[model samples]
Target: MIKFLLIVNRQGQLRLRKYFEEKVVTHGEQREIIRQCLSAVDKQNFLVEFKDFTVVYKKYGNLYFIAGITSNENELAVLELMHHMVETLDKYFDRVSEIDILYSLDRVHMVIDEMVVNGYILETSQPRILVPLQLLDVARK
Candidate 1:
């Protein structure tokens, strides 16, 4: 499975680190899906590779983290949508002090955890729970 760990800094820059498993398990157009997913984020390309379809990162910066099990056959739209959502969140949360966000509640999906000290933003450390894209759409129903 392919795992993506995306992080955001106080500078509003996004960094994505892909976890390559070194053994391709889900094969048959994996790159194509990734391409489309990148496009959905308004990005032309992604620095991603796979091995066994697994990508693991212990952590990143003082702001974010995620973990997921993705197969070659996983829907492109889903991956793209998730990434898009992450981008959107980063844009709006300019002054977040801390947040614990889960990518998906359905399976053993990704987790995004951040800690923004008052020194970083202000004397305000309001915690928030950012919902997964799937759930964000669901409650609107």
Candidate 2:
């Protein structure tokens, strides 16, 4: 199961964080991890093994979309999920960017929730994930 997800920018600033399990971590610890992630030389290395968890990340433009999971989890599946998430966002916002995400954080959060429920991955279908968002958008009008 996935533990947490973190989206950070090129400057090592965290853009979004979602914790599936209850884990109390200090700001300093998170900052240290961000520092290491930002300083990584091999951008192609998608999996980074930490002490307690493994991180799977993909660099998208200036943002790094990451998933933190246990050692026993499926690395490839998580990586695919991350890519699917980016593609879903791109379709929703006509090419997603940091500015677009910041402007429509609610939509992003909704999409995330649709894709993952209680830390477990749901469906990979774009239409399945966007159903809620589409319904909400229709209702708002």
Candidate 3:
């Protein structure tokens, strides 16, 4: 399958964005892996135009939230492939415990869940987490 990824170079300047025609030998591997990738980049309660961390997946686009010299752009490859999501995440690399961490879908999801729970929110989807908005609202109440 032709998968694309967005990766930020060592310079932290939205420099890398490319279409990777990665071939998956195993059946359904691409779908599953993509799900995982999205999961890694996932963060719940990331509202658009909020001037904070976010990650979004469109039909074939990306929207970067953290827009500055010190943005968490390690997912440059993922951002290039899909709509860049999440911004203002520099603290991930600034904090003592978060600095040494690697950004992945699972990690993102966990952090997002924690934040939402901390903020007293019921739950949130990754803009494209499979769960429909209508359902989410029902669950929220």
Candidate 4:
């Protein structure tokens, strides 16, 4: 199972976070975990295994899209899901950036909700994820 999803910038600050499971640590500890994870990787894609969970992350532009999952979960699958999430965000925002995600936080969360439920991947197709968001955008106008 997945533990959490996080979007952190190069500055080591979190842009967005979603937790699927129970809290196993305090806010500070969580921050520490993120910090450690970020520090551990220098590449665009990586999987870091911790004591209790594993981190799968991919870098996009200036932000790091990271997901935490149980050790038993498929790392490659989680990584692909993370890429899909980014692509969905890209489609929604035209061009994805930290500022775009910040401004469209609610919409971004909507995409996240559509893609992941209870830490499991709900959809993989871009069109499946984009249709609802497009409808929502049209309705908002």
Number of the predicted model whose lDDT against the real structure is largest: 2
Model 2 stretches astray by more than 4 angstroms: none
Candidate 4: where is the Cα deviation over 4 Å?
A: 41-45
**Compared to the true structure, candidate 2 yields what TM-score?**
0.93
List where candidate 3 sits over 4 angstroms from the true fold. 1-85, 94-109, 116-141
Candidate 4 per-residue C-alpha lDDT over 59-117 given as tens digits, one digit per residue, 9 for 90 to 100:
77888888888877999998888888888888778879999988888888888888889
Query: What TM-score against the true fold does each predicted structure earn?
Result: 0.27, 0.93, 0.20, 0.91
Tens digits of lDDT, candidate 2, 1-141: 898888889998788888888863467867777777777899677877776888788888999887888888899999888999999999988899998878788898888898988888998899989888889889999
Model 2 lDDT at residue 115 = 91
RMSD of each: 14.2, 1.2, 15.9, 1.6
Q: Poorest 10 consecutive residues of model 2 by lDDT?
A: 23-32
TM-score order, best first, reads: 2, 4, 1, 3
Residue 140, candidate 1: Cα error in Å is 27
- lDDT per residue, candidate 1, 70-123, as tens digits? 554244433453454344455444432234333322211222222122112111
Model 3 accuracy (lDDT, Cα): 0.31
| Model 1, runs deviating above 4 Å | 1-4, 8-43, 54-69, 72-75, 95-141
